[model samples]
Target chain A: MITQRAANIAFNILVIVAAVFFALEAETFQTSGLLASTGLPSKFFPQLMLAFIGLCSVIVIGAYVFRGFAGTDKGASVFEDGGAARRGLLVLAVAVACYLVWSLWSFIPMLILIGPACALAMGVRSPWMYVSLLVMSGIVYLVFTQLLNVQLT
Target chain B: MFAGFDVVAQSIGQLAEPITLALLVGGIVLGLIIGVLPGLGPPIAIALALPFTFHLEPIAAIILLLGIYSAAIYGGSISAIAVGIPGTGAAIATVQDGNKMFKAGKGGEALGLSLTGSIIGGLFSVICLAFIAPILATVAIKFGPREFLAISVFGLVVVVRVAGESLSKGLLVGALGIFLTTWGLDELNGTERYTFGSYHLYEGIPLVPFLVGVFAVSEVLIGAERALQKLDFDQTSLTVKLPGWGKLMKMKDVLFRSSALGTVIGIIPGEGAAVAAFFAYSEAKRRSKTPEKFGTGHDEGIVAPETANNATVGGALVPTLTLGVPGSPAAAVLLGAFLIHGLAPGPKLFAERPDMMYAIFIGLFIINILMMVIGLMAIRFAAKLIQVPTTFIVPTVLLLSFVGIFSVSHSFFNVGVLLGAGILGYVVRKLGYSIAPLSIGFVLGPILENSLRQSLVIADGSVGEFFNTPIGLGIYAALALTIFGGPLAGWVKNKMFQRAEDA
Candidate 1:
């Protein structure tokens, strides 16, 4: 269980790192022609936002580090328990897998597999749920293809 | 204003078409079903319906979505009354007294009050929208870039302030959302900022996919974590018994006050139905003769939040239609629908599309009336929908999101964007950050960037001239009050308490 204090500190550190990377990346942004003489450079808004985010991240890190809690929750964990963390992460993984299958192969195969994959991720033992989900997916597929004429690849 | 009656008549005639009528009813039923399901709200309902609306006529699509919007807010109270669980964030306040009344065997009366209050509030706000939107649009037509900048700043700041307990988290996410929008080529100079050599990157992150991902897919993932939870509730109490004229008259003051409060709040750029509901609930309690009865099956308790939440539908549309600012998260998605139809909502929409405008206003009035009739008939059926397991919903919602987003542009890049956004939303939400600021900031990003840049060029780097416009100054004043009012009130209350102690 990752306590919110620990999570906040870790997340803020990640934000700061990403912000720094993005800010540095902003420096690489180049423009030319008439656009180059515009009121502000292309990098101005992004860099300003990155700096603001980095500053906020630092403040969050300091608050969590010194006071041992963010102002909102005293010491709640990011996830409720190990079970919740497992289920959430697994479902997320399933979603990515579904997306990957669609990207790699085709939409139909992904559609056929996504329901069972998500159900499996959630630890569902019911056979009926899997059947219902497949039926629901088929309904969705037909509605979009037949009714809306969406060319689902 | 009366000169537009012919256009209104023509819009009303257009809605009388069989297809339009059917879609309106269908949208209502779908909205109610989605609203009865916990973790699904008006925004998700609208998001999921967006793809289907692509094939619809503009008026028909807008009407269908309007039906869904008004009814979904009303539908949430069904679950709130039938069970302790609120079907939507807007219905959270209804859970306290609504469920208590349900448990006490006065469920019929509770459902009835909620239904009545919702209709009354929804209709009142629609009337207010009809009158106020055109006037506001007329005023907004003259707003320059500096005024727009001021408005955008006010919106972003207000959303961050009201979003959560931690101001920094809200600002961080809001800034991040705006930052994400800066990825595409700059609109002004056509400079590629972060395209990374991909054609899909030129347009930046797509709005519909990102929004659906943030609201729907993120919720689907979160719902999966609690998939094993089951619900079993008494179906006998789902029947709605609407209040008599006398009973309605008795609660007229509450209805009127909540509707007005909700409309006012909804007109504020980023404040939403949930905030309005909670505020109305607290106000009802504060003003009640028997405040102690509020959480204990009080009828006024159910009425206040239900009315306020439904009222926000029309109120929120004020800013959305007139200013293109999106008055709520749901309105944000509705804005996506407008963009999908190649119509930009703002002062120009009213001028260019008066028929469409009239269609929306008239269609909303009809939707509210139909919602009452449909809500009463369908409450029992919707209550049964509450027991549907999360296991079924999780996979189905995920699948729908996949198919719907894929159908939008047939691009896997968009699907990837949707998935990425969902992950981001889930992570932030789990960590107790409100998604409102992030979503609103995303909507406001283009306007903020364009206006700020334009204002800077116009002012020639003079900081004092930035506040030159009267509208800009007025907006800034309102922003300041919104930011400082709560703390100032708290300080004054504390001082008074201390003085009393001394006395």
Candidate 2:
């Protein structure tokens, strides 16, 4: 339900905080031993970028505060509706969950689950859709692990 | 610009091979299929196909990928004309006139015009690439770190300016992309920047995984939002009726102008087919005696954008092949393919492997000609792809990306990086930021960092010394004009408008 105005302001504010924090972290960057005196310090590029990012982020925040929008898209909603937000977030969760499943167990279970899980997250009620997804996952397994011999460990 | 006879012979021999020919055809077909589907574009299509390229010869692999690249851009018009939803961003400009024509019972004519315009555009750019690339390579061979720095800055700035409406958001993401590259050990000095105590990250983020996640996986998340809806388009009127020479002659100026405009825009780093399409579309409209006919199914309307979009393929490759700087986002991903094959795309590639360079030039020319035949045959099937549910595509693409990244390396960490990058892409995209600048920024980051630091040392820390070179200074001047020109022009136009009203 948040308009793009609120989102841009919040996002840019966070970006500013992160830029300052990371710029501070760049101070810890050092080249030890023989590389100590090599050219510019490693922190040079990162810190420069962080400062530029911070400056840009502040402008973005300022625009939102003053004009009620950061860009040309004025007072727009972030999502089309509550349903779209729910589905998008849930699909994202399914993706993360699929990755965790692979990391925790093995690629096989994750492969079998990823498609069905994603379909379910998108609110598919059709068993045929689930069945089609599982079949696709099977094809994927064969193509990569069997035919291509990628050893998807 | 011709290479030695032996180099051409070698390239032709390899291209004539049964496997390479088959892959070329297969690449185009696959590209058409993927491009017909909404939410998938050239970059993602190429990224998904990168894994399968491992087993092929270098030329074959490259041709396969290039086939995908060229065909994918062209393939987008099929869905755009038929379904009104563009299959790729480059096809968006085509949709307005294309769909209107289709709905007016001229679907076949619209498709044919797009097809003809695309082929003409693609072939025109290939010729330009062949003539122009060698000269550019020869000149670029003498370029130093400062020149590269200018090119990198030019590329990043152009992308940021065009990618989105908000300058600040684009800059933020562009800076973020560059900062991420600051991870891993510094190449200049053996300094660990942001490895975060992981041995795997010592080399920093892998390019293929990051790009795939950004384009493919993020699209998957976005597609998931409306997966329940099934796409439908008119199955009738799907036949392609190409324009005759009489009709073609009437719009020859648009074709040539759009091709040239597209090629020039393509040569500019970070400006992509999509930008070229929109630019050419607008230019055509502005120049037209019947400007009002645009967006209502004018044949020239269909021709201009389609031609420009496909022309960008060749235009984009010029900088990518000769300069190692990608000309577009898909070219950025294509650069990753070159890296995978132990080939670095730069001026040195032209000198070291003239055969490979000739192969690309010749192969792309063949691809354009072949697209005319194959595109017509595949139009019916491609139209059906527009009908596939988003739910089906979401899972298939997500799985493909997950497996595709893992297939590249057997490491879990690479897959993890893919997911992380995908999430980042999704978040930013949802926030109304275009990922073009982010992707290009990531591609150019290392070059920018190295060149800046190296030039700093070479100049003895004098900022003025960085632009001492004639080429570098010229580039900076162009960059300056590109940044300030639009605002200045708009201001003048506004003042003139006000004066007219006052009078």
Candidate 3:
């Protein structure tokens, strides 16, 4: 099991990185004249938020370093077992695959990707589940294309 | 208000169409199915339904969504009673007594009690919404930028406190959400904020796709991890015996008090149905003659939490419809549906779209009433709905989400945004962060920014002037009291306990 201290440290690092990136991005806005005349410039809110986040990241990291971890009971790893991690990542890969297919071929290819991809990810040995998934996908296709008359490019 | 009755009547007439009625029934049935399925709650249900509403008329679309919202909360109770696992977060409190009763061979009674309580709570909250929303809207009409900013601050802070155990974690996620909304061109100056020269980025990330991605796709990824685990449960007797008027009359005080408490809590910005349910459950236990029977499957225990949770549906809608600040995560998604239909929810909504108001009021009333009848007829079918294999549901829901998001914008870029948000939501959720604050923050982002900017201008850059408004001051004081008062009181209690122990 991954300790809460390690997780908090990792998350804080991510937050700090994101905050710095946003702070740099906020530098592009030119605060002048009417924009400045409005009492606050457009960049003020975003910069303030970025700074607040950075401050909070520091606090979290310090707390983790001092207190170790807050709620160890609920701090179980997402990957409790190897199989769970594999199945989970596989599902995500399938989603990415579907997106790729949609980008290349269109909605039809995406629709086709749904059943086989999810079935394979879930490790469904039963042919019946696949048949049902196919039928359900077809019904969704008909509903969107025929009844709503949405042109799926 | 009476002068607008004709328009209200016309909108009511439009909803009475046969097609609309059928859709309402269909939505409730579908909602129950989604809710009963473990890991899919109201937010996911609504997100999945968003694309289907694109071709619907405004009234029908809203009615369908409303039906789904109400029924999903109620549907969660079924799984809680049958199995120890709560189907939704709102049902978590219901599991203690409900599952106990089930194990005691009184599953039928537990289910019936939950059903009755849910309907009563839902109806009570709808009545509260109908009465409170207009009054609040009327008051909101007088609000300036300062007041709006105060309200937004109150919302964001309250949500951050209620969402997670760690306040910093909640605020961190919320700030991240708001910052993500700053990607498009500035509406005030037309200067690009973070639009990386992409035309799609010009509009910023679209709300519907992003929401669908966050709620549905994230769950799909999580669901994939545990899909192979079989849910084993024996259904010996599935009979439902709804309480008679005499029994209900005996518990009328509990019903009324819990409903009222639920509604009031719902009206608060961040505390949602789950909070209301737990609070009401604890209150009921505290007041009961025999509090020891609470987790041991007492009828009042079931009624209190079940009623409060269902009633929260109506309570959560008050701010969503009147102020555009969703009182819950589910309401946030519903708010997205409103934006999709070009309806900006606020005080002007009442003045400009009285018909829409009437539609929601009447439609919600009908949804609650119909929920009772439908819930009874569908209970057996609803139980079977949970038995649908995950293998089929996973692909079907994914297809729906993919097609739905695509149909809304007809843009592949929006689909990409949906996937991105899904991955982000999944990652954050796995890391022990609650999505409630992030979702609510995203919905409240523009309002927060616009109001803060406007308020600063109105206050002439004086920080003191920003806190000058009595309403704003009162709200901030109340928020401060809520956040700090808890820890202070806890400290005093601990000291007192130590002294007592020494004595």
State the interface C-alpha RMSD of candidate 3: 2.1
lDDT, each prediction: 0.90, 0.91, 0.84
Pairs that clash in candidate 2: none
- For residues B91-209, could you state the per-residue lDDT of candidate 1 as single tens digits? 99999999999999999999999999999899999999999999999999999999999888988888888889998889999998899999998998888877888999999999999
For model 2, the superposed segments whose C-alpha errors exceed 4 Å read B490-503
Q: State residue B158's C-alpha deviation in candidate 2, in Å.
A: 0.5
Per-residue lDDT tens digits for candidate 3, residues B383-408, read 76667777777777777888889888
| Candidate rank order under lDDT | 2, 1, 3
Candidate 1, A2-101: lDDT as tens digits: 8888878888899999999888888988887877997888888889889999998988888788887665688788887888888899999999998999
Per-residue lDDT of B1-503 in model 2, one digit per residue for the tens?
Answer: 56789899999999999999999999999988998888899999999999889777899999999999999998899999998989999999999999999999999999999999999999999999999999999999999999999999999999999999988899889888888888898898878777778999889999999999999989998988987777777889899999999999999999999999999999999999989999999999999999999999999989999999999999999999999999999999999999999999999999899999999999999999999999899898888888888989998998898888888787889989999999999989988888998899999999999999989988996767766889998998999999998999999999999999999
For model 3, the DockQ equals 0.61
Better of 1 and 3 by DockQ: 1
User: Which residues of candidate 1, in runs, are more than 4 Å off?
Assistant: B1-3, B496-503
Q: Cα lDDT for residue A117, model 1?
A: 89
TM-scores, each model vs. reference: 0.98, 0.98, 0.96
